[model samples]
Target: MDKLALTFELSYYLWGLLTLTIPIAIHLLSKHRGKLVPFAHIALIKVKNSPQLNQARLTQWLLLILRLLMLLVACAILAQLVWSKNADTSANLVLVSNDWLAQSSDAEKQQLFEDLNSSQNSRLFIIDGLNQSLSQRKLESKALLAFQGDTSSTTTPPLNIWANLAEISKTLPKAQKIQLYTTNRLNQFTGQKVAITNPIEWHIKSLPNTLPETKLTASLTIVSDANYQQQLLYVRGALDALATTLPLDLNIEYLDSSLVQEDLDLSQQQSHIIYLADAPLPTELVNSATSIISSEQLQGYTQADFPLTLATKLFAAQTKQWFADNARLSNQQITELPNLDLVNQQQTNTGNAQSLHLWLILILVILFMTERLLSEWPNKHSRQVEGN
Candidate 1:
């Protein structure tokens, strides 16, 4: 198999390269101005040694080169030039979910391995509870045996390992085809949708399992806007009693008017929510709600341009303990593998800019020291005696 390779790409502030002309222009414009004295014979002095003229010309050229190098180095530092090592684009990534090969004959397994080896860039990984690369497992026979002997069954909830799809997505070094091998068990799926920015062509082999559907518990959260202080208190009184009566975990939130318009962030582990607010919610917030109460009992409009509204009932029938008892058994997080949506909302970039800066600094110092040594070497020789 061909080794995993990276291509080198360089990026810098392009305008900095144009500054190279500055040093060359100075070298061309500056000429030695000679103080000439009146003389009877311009030819009296022996013709200046040809060797000395050649040596002086050589010195000027060397000095020009050194000065230009110094300027270029400084510009590079300011431009923050960086080199990026990118993974091979043409390489194929094949994730062999063990379930795909579980029931296949030995001949099929051999054929699959042969097909993979045919492509120089094909890399295979096995995914179940963990993603293990075939390269690391060296012994193909042992790896296949291990896959067949997988004891982490989805039938038992406590023994089952819930593979976090969001976390799995982050482990991917680059965008590639994703394959999942598993039995169709409800416990394996996440409570919420997983949103991945990468465009992965998913190939799944979900073998039907004998396990019954895993029952999930539910949570109820209530949020009220600041303008409705009296309303918030009334809702809390009703729900707080329901929490004790039905033994339900009730989370209550009161947001100020300034903070009310902000979108509420949700996670797979979190409960479905009920929001009571007067202001119009953002598109995302409206879509996330299980239920919303935008107003109360009374409603009226003045004959003029004035608007008036009132509510006769502070707590409705839906806000009672009976509704919460039924809500606890709702199937909010159950789904099959393909349409499963488990979201990992945290985003972090992997680049280390500080490390790059340190490397550039080290190179710049080395170039400065080299230039200094070369500049003073010619003078040191000039100071020595001719016949020493």
Candidate 2:
């Protein structure tokens, strides 16, 4: 657990001591003052009328002691002083998180889950929407359900991460350490305690060499599904990643909107056409195009030519295979391919084990044990002195 200090916590024990001691001292000292009574044989009266000996004073002292004990208990809990000897010693390894991102290819997600599966004594917290649960399994054999539906940012804001971390700390024994496996998205979170030991950042960069305008090309086509009337489709490719945004003359395309936002449903055979005025065909697209139609007939396509091979490779890839094999097909086959710069890359690294941190936690447990014993020793000595 991350330690945070409350300003007035230390003062509670001091207050308790002062409250009890001041009253006791006053009562003891007051006895030294001599007093006179009008009645004869007042010694019996003096014994009965002693000021400190009362049920109310005893109750007050008991309350002060109880308050002090309560404060110490609270402090111990806040400090996570309780350590479980039987807790899994292998490594606390609380799954910081496992999630999917659009930036990652379908293959990357599969490999990532595999890596998580391989970690021994590790818990899995799959972040689909919130976080899904899975029984621990072998890394190689673990099967993860592919993330489907919209790949856009989550609708609601992510769960309170700090609160999640706090809860995780409580669930595990104080002896065990913690680790996080969050995506780059969580890098925004700063100043976290619980010792983030090793965080691996994933970066996927696509290197695209500009194809000469002379390299053969074809028209940019947008495909949609039967249900696409409710959704918007935007044709995004490598050019968007390189520069600010895709550079296409929307005037050539006589469509409702040139800007596509939602995922394009190529499941059904619906296709949107773009017309170009003076743009030459991209090498990838023209080579893949079965029939090249007249240029004047096209109205809404971009004047800037895109590669034909890039389009064919992208459309033929798993993105298209997923739709063809899984998604329901329609009668109309999409012929005009969108400008696509498909990137297929993987990065795998083995993490180094950290055992020194475990030793540090052990030292802390010993310190807490020693402190508890020492605190009780003083009380025992005080009682012995009183008995003597």
lDDT of 1 by residue, 1-388 (tens): 2223222123255467687898689778866567988777775877666774576567768878877776766666665554433334466655554444554456656765676677777655555544443345233432543445333433222112134334444434344344333333333342444454344544433443332222223444455666666655655555554445343433545555446455356322234444556666666656753444454432222212111121113223323322221222112322223342343333321221122456667777876777787667667656663546
In order, the Cα lDDT scores of the candidates are 0.47, 0.36
Q: Could you list the CA RMSD of all candidates, in the order they appear?
A: 15.4, 19.0
Minimal lDDT window, size 10, model 2: 343-352
| Candidate 2 per-residue C-alpha lDDT over 1-388 given as tens digits, one digit per residue, 9 for 90 to 100 | 2222222212334433344455456556745856865776764764564343464455445544444444444444433332222335364253423333333456756765666677765544433222432223112224343544243422222333333544444434334555444433322122232321122122222212222222222234432333333222223333243134323322112222222223233112122233222344444334442333322333223324333332333333423332322222121211112222221122111121122334445554665565565446546755896999
In model 1, which runs have C-alpha deviations exceeding 4 angstroms? 1-12, 31-40, 50-59, 71-87, 98-111, 128-147, 150-153, 156-198, 209-357, 370-388
Candidate 1 lDDT at 250 equals 37
Q: Would you estimate the TM-scores of all the predictions?
A: 0.46, 0.28
What is the Cα root-mean-square deviation between model 2 and the actual structure?
19.0
